[model samples]
Structures are given as C-alpha cells and as structure tokens.
Target: MKTVSFLTKKLGFGLIWLLLGLGLFSCEPDPIEIDLPAHEPKLVIATQVFPAKYMVVQVSKSFSSLAGDGKEMNADTTFLKTLAVEHALVQINFNGQTETLKHVRNGFYVSRNIPQHFQQRYTLTVRDSVSGLECTAATEMLAPVNFEKLEPEVKRTEKDTTVTLHFTLADPGPERNFFLISLVGANRKNLLPKNKIGSFNAVQEQIILVNHGAFTNGKYEGKERLTLETSDTLLVSLSNISEPYYNYLQLYQKSGSLMNQLTGEPINLPTNIQNGYGFFSAHNPTAQVFKISER
Candidate 1:
C-alpha cells in the first residue's frame, strides 16, 4: 500500500510538469518596438492684422513622400496626426476668453463670435508634436502687419515658346512677411502666399512660367492669372488665378505604399524642407506669384 501511494504521487507530479511545459511554449512572443521617423509637418497660420478675426492654416505633405516612400501605413491615422499643432490655444478675437477656438478637421481651426474690440489681440498657444516637443508658444497678438506690394517682371522667349514672370525685391522687412497673389478671377479667400507653386524663382529674380501641370501644352490657355493682396491694408484681398491658372497646393498630392499602412508609424518623409513639401506650419512659407507672357 505504501509503494502504491508513492507511485500515485509521482504520477501526479509528472502530469503537472507536462502541463507547465505546454503552457510555456503556447504563449506568443512579445511584440517588438522600433523607432519611426517623424513626419515633421509644417503649419501655416493665415490672419491679417485688424478686425482680423479669422485665420486659414495650411500644411503640405513633404516632396519625398510625393515621389513614393511609405508602402504600408494609413496616412490619416499616423501622418496627419502630426499636423503642426500639438497642444495649443489660438486666440481669435478679444473676448479675453480662451475657450473660443475650435479645431475643425485635421488642419482647420475656427473661433466662435467674440465681442469686437479695435486693434484686438489674437495669438496661438501650440504644442509641437515633435519628439523634442514644446507645447506652449503663446505669441503675443497685437495687430496685423501691413501689406507688401509686388512689382512683377515678365519676359518672353520666341525660340522655346516660353514666357517668364519675375519679381523685384519686396520690402516686407522681417516679421515673417509674405506676398499674396490672385490669378485672374479667383476669390479673395482663395489666395495664398505665393511660394507653394512649382518651379520658379531661379537665376535673376523670383520668376515663374506656366508649366504642364497648369496645362497640357506647358502654357496658359486662359485658365489662370494672379492678384496680390495683403493684411493691414484695405478691407479686401487682391485676388489672382488662371491666365494659364494651375491647381492650388493640394494636401492629397503625396501618397505612398500600402505597406506603411501595415504599421501605425507616421509615414516618414525622406527629404528636408528644401526638397520636400515644407511642413504644415505657420512657418511653411509661400512667396509671391509671378506670371509669363509669350515673346
């Protein structure tokens, strides 16, 4: 009876050991973590000086991604999440209240009606989503800066059947100045600071020519023209677009591999500001627009 009892205990111990081994092997391996490149999107905030109640912010996907980079990622979930503002407050009008700014979509912000005040102050308290994050950048709002004028220089070449438009120096002295242009019949609100257009400002002065993107034959077929406007000037924006008007800077121009979708990583843009789309930020600058005429 004693020997039988001992054998029973041994068998029970053996069963327990077997179960433990199976459980250990059946467990899944721990997930691996890899550091991903940051999108470093740029942010552009548009609001001209007084009664200056509203703003239009812009962001462009870098150029590298435009050429094909990420192969397995959902851009909306990852890349757009990095849109210029991290954690910040934008003061629209002088209600002395900070609760008015509403974040619209990924890159839009609107402020509800605020009590009107002359020369009212408005600014932003933004958080940078970069790894070296800086959240509180409360810019002291005073009034909108005055508008700068643009004197465009236009030239034409008979041999190449091409025309070039250039600009003389603008005297917007510091403080992040920009020139806004309207192409022909575009509305005032549709105007943007000019630098976002493709390929110009080389050699002599800031010059541009109608290209294939603007038309099938690389020349304006009366589709666009430009009108320059400024803040702190008159009550309206000087508008522009299409004598051979090309398309506006679109956010959807850059797309890459579905492989990036496989991972939750923000699609890494391969180039810096000069080569890629300048990030979506107040700092992503747009220069003045120039036009070309046939020689």
Candidate 2:
C-alpha cells in the first residue's frame, strides 16, 4: 500500500485552476458619474461714499464656485468681460431723494451730486434689466471724530532705538466704534510684528490695524500706540468705521491669510448687500502727517 500526503499533486492543480478561473471572471468597477446643478449669479457691489467727494460704485456679478479657474493667466480680456456688470442701472437715494448714477465705463458708476452728510443714510439700488435682478443696501455715514496728534516717544538701547507714536481720542460714550490706523512712507518692503503685536504691512509702506483691534468708551477711549524700529515721515489715517464694516474687517483680519485658509476652516466674508454680495460701507477718515525720528 502506498501512503499519500494531504497536499497531493491533483489537489494542488485543482486549487491553482480555481484561482485562475476566478481571476478570468473578475472585472474592474465602472467610474461614478456626478451631475451638478447649474449655478445662479448674484449682484456684487463695492461702494464707499464719503463726505465732499464724488460717489463711485463698482458693480459686478458674483462668480460660481464651479466656474472656470479664477486665476489670471492669459485671461485678461475675458476676465474683465466676465466680472463686470455692463448693463446695469444704478442709483443713489438720499433722504428720500433719488439720483441716477451715470455709467462711465466698465461697470463703474459715478454721481456728482451725492449727499455726503454725516449721520445720513444712503440707499444704493442696482437693477439688471436682462436678468430682472435687483439689489439694494443701506449705509449711514458717521461723523468724523477728533483725535490728538502727539509726538512719538523715543526709546534708546545699546543695539537700536525704537520710536513709538501715540494716538488718543475720547471714545463716543455708550456707542461702539471701530478704528483703523495706518502708516505710510516708511520706505521698507516689510515690517516685522514686534513683541507679539499684530501689525501688518501693506504696499507703499503702510501699516494696518490688526488683532480685532477695537475700542469702546470704557476701556481704551480710542488710544492706540504704534512702535517702529526705523525713523521716517509717517502719514497716519485714523478711520471711524461702522459696526457692519467693523465686523467684516474683523472676520477678514482673523482669517484672511492663505495659511489660515489652507490649515483651518473656511471663512465666509460678511456681506450687507440685500440679494447680492460684497459690502457697502461708509467710513470717516482723519489724516495727519508726522515725522518719526530716532534720538
């Protein structure tokens, strides 16, 4: 009698044939198809009306998220055509009086006789006849506030000297206020935020306010201190913005960087336009010139 092992030649051949048969019958899965709905465009308006100045309004249509890449490579001609709302009727209503704005070119509307009174409410109306879409928004201009222009305090050290400027004002009691401080003519490409201060630099050597930096009547009383390492002629503009404007800026200021968008949650900008996008705000700015010299 011959002894046979459990792994016999016939059984090994049978298992190999079974696997080959299964492999021959297997098929790759089909790709999934997704059908997205069409996107509707909304009106976008960016207008800032100030005292004793011509009202300028920029009208455009909001783009869909699924639209073509918003990048600007060989898209100069078509980009301009796509963003502008060329055939829209714009108007400004002030204290129950309406004035039609003239379309000067490329979706820019201008009005010479706009009421720019302080504490006055102005209404903006935009109508697209082809799409029968209309958008309206209201904003009130704040009265300009007075601030003290004091000399900068100089601090000397063994390595370098630091110049600090102080701006002080009596905050309007009981009412909330937003302030933006900026410096220009510094003649530097960048500014490093020193001592954990949230100061940001703009082109043309301007420094903007940061850190949800706001003041109320009780605490700061509209006092701001600016410190710089080098000395230059600084032109400062302190703007008193509305609450809605403040919220908008604060949101953007907090989450405006590309790093924040890449690593953190998405940020949606706050808009006050009814049936539209973008912000319509009125700000009162008081400008002063000063020289920051190191001692």
Query: Model 1 over residues 194-284: C-alpha lDDT tens digits?
Result: 7453422111011122222333222222212232233211121232211111121221122222222122223333221222232212211
Candidate 2 yields a Cα-based lDDT of: 0.60
lDDT of 2 by residue, 121-170 (tens): 98889998767777999888777755654445657789965555655655
Candidate lDDT values, in order? 0.31, 0.60
Worst 10 residues of 2 by lDDT: 257-266
Per-model TM-score, in order, reads: 0.31, 0.63
> In model 2, what lDDT does residue 191 have?
36
Model 2 residue 55 CA deviation (Å) reads: 2.1
Off by over 4 Å in 2: 1-30, 70-81, 130-132, 150-170, 182-236, 254-267, 289-295
Task: Give RMSD (Å) of candidate 2 vs. truth.
Answer: 15.5
Clashing pairs in 2: none
RMSD to the true structure for each prediction, in A, is 20.1, 15.5
